[model samples]
Target: MKHNALAIALTLLLSALLGLALWWDYRRNATPHPTPGPASFPIDTRSAARPAPAPTQALPHNGLYRCDGPAGTSYQSHPCTPGSRQGDVSGGTLSTVTVPPPRPLPPPVASVETPTPKVGLIARGPRPGEGNEALCAMHERDIKRIDEAARRGQSSESQEWLREQRRWHKDEMWRLACGR
Candidate 1:
């Protein structure tokens, strides 16, 4: 009993030491973050170099002026330079492609004869010896869904519970004598 107590005490001490070592290692290796304070705030280096913002007032939408400058002809929304000659801008028409309307669909043909059911509920389920393909397919789908749920990692159920559910599904497949 004393030996068991001593072993337990040693295990607890080792666990505590390991935890402390891990915590210390994490703290030492972790990136240092600057504390939020007035002195620690970042300076705007571009504040002086930055250009003043344009006026928010809307410009007049008067007709565009075509200016023939000394260098080349240029288009401007406002009056050009003092020596440059300006003209009233005109016609640059864009031709649009016209799409023809779609043709109407053909009417569905009506069936005169009534359809007869071949298999019932008992026929769909598993028989004495031979297994049902539909049930086996459904089981496979359920197993895949369970695996997907496990991978998503957002389930309210524990991993153990999910594993149990998977096992249960596999057991059900065996009980149903599927894939025979």
Candidate 2:
């Protein structure tokens, strides 16, 4: 009973000390924001007054005219005078070219037949001692080669597929009773 009471007293004292320390830290770091008072300068009056600008006259037509004079070629706001020879100003003459039709494509070549990959026996093993020793040894060698390829980061097959092949080889060895 005495130990329990002492523990409770120490816990309460530690909590109170923590609360006081947090409150002191908060008070020390906090900044007080003063309430805003009235501003010093006047903001209602307009300082300098400006006058309205004058309007401009509109043109009759916006097209530009070209005129060849004695002082070289000159551009004017008016057209070339009557009975006078005028140069072509609406872009120079255009030349046209005849394009030949594309030749028809040749017929596709016949596709060649691809040879199929060789597959091993699945689920079942060869007869024990019936020329299966060589087969089991081949499987063991395949497992070792696949493992070495994986260790050297040169494996062509996926990790999961390689693991499945290894399991198949182990199963084949067990079923053939290779070393037994």
Candidate 3:
């Protein structure tokens, strides 16, 4: 009987300890918490409600204008009228104006000189009617001789004859012979 009573006492102590542990765990997890819902923040509404300021206007259109003032002269849209006296506020000086008159250009001078003709040596073989039959025949014979000399590698003789032939067949000679 003593053994059975000791067993019952042990069982009751274990049950009480388990119940205390459960109660402590429940209390630790039960503190008041924030509700699980959506959150919001404040926003500034003045920037959205106010409209933007207007842009500045451009200067007036008059004509080409130039300014000469005491505070570093510069160009501007509206120039002061001629003979108008204006005082500079910053420099404290009165402005003086001078109007320029439109001058007439001199009449284009008429030319009296005649243009001279350009003259140069001709390079082609022989101009038509450059010489009388005998002279032309002589020229043809000289050219043939020069060609024969060139073929034989006598370049100096060929070149000399070519110069002579060119001189003989000048434009004036051709014109005279051709009656042009």
Point to the candidate with the largest TM-score: 1
> In terms of lDDT, which candidate is strongest?
1
Q: How accurate is candidate 2 locally (lDDT)?
A: 0.67
Candidate 3 residue-wise lDDT, 1-180, digit = tens: 999999999999999999999999999899867776668567668776885432233224333344444554554445444433222223133454688998999999998965555456433455566556676566556657656655665567667876676666554346456433
Q: Against the true structure, what is each candidate's TM-score?
A: 0.27, 0.26, 0.20
Question: What tens-digit string does per-residue lDDT give for candidate 2 at 1-180?
Answer: 999999999999999999999999999889665657666687545643543222232223334445555556754556655433334355444344579999999999999966555456333545565778788889889999878756765445677677788889888888887776
Where in model 3 is the C-alpha error above 4 Å? 1-99, 108-141, 150-180
RMSD of each: 26.8, 26.9, 30.1
Q: State the weakest 10-residue window (summed lDDT) of model 3.
A: 84-93
Poorly placed runs, candidate 2 (over 4 Å): 1-130, 154-157
lDDT per prediction?
Answer: 0.74, 0.67, 0.58
For candidate 3, give the lDDT of residue 55: 24
TM-score of 2: 0.26
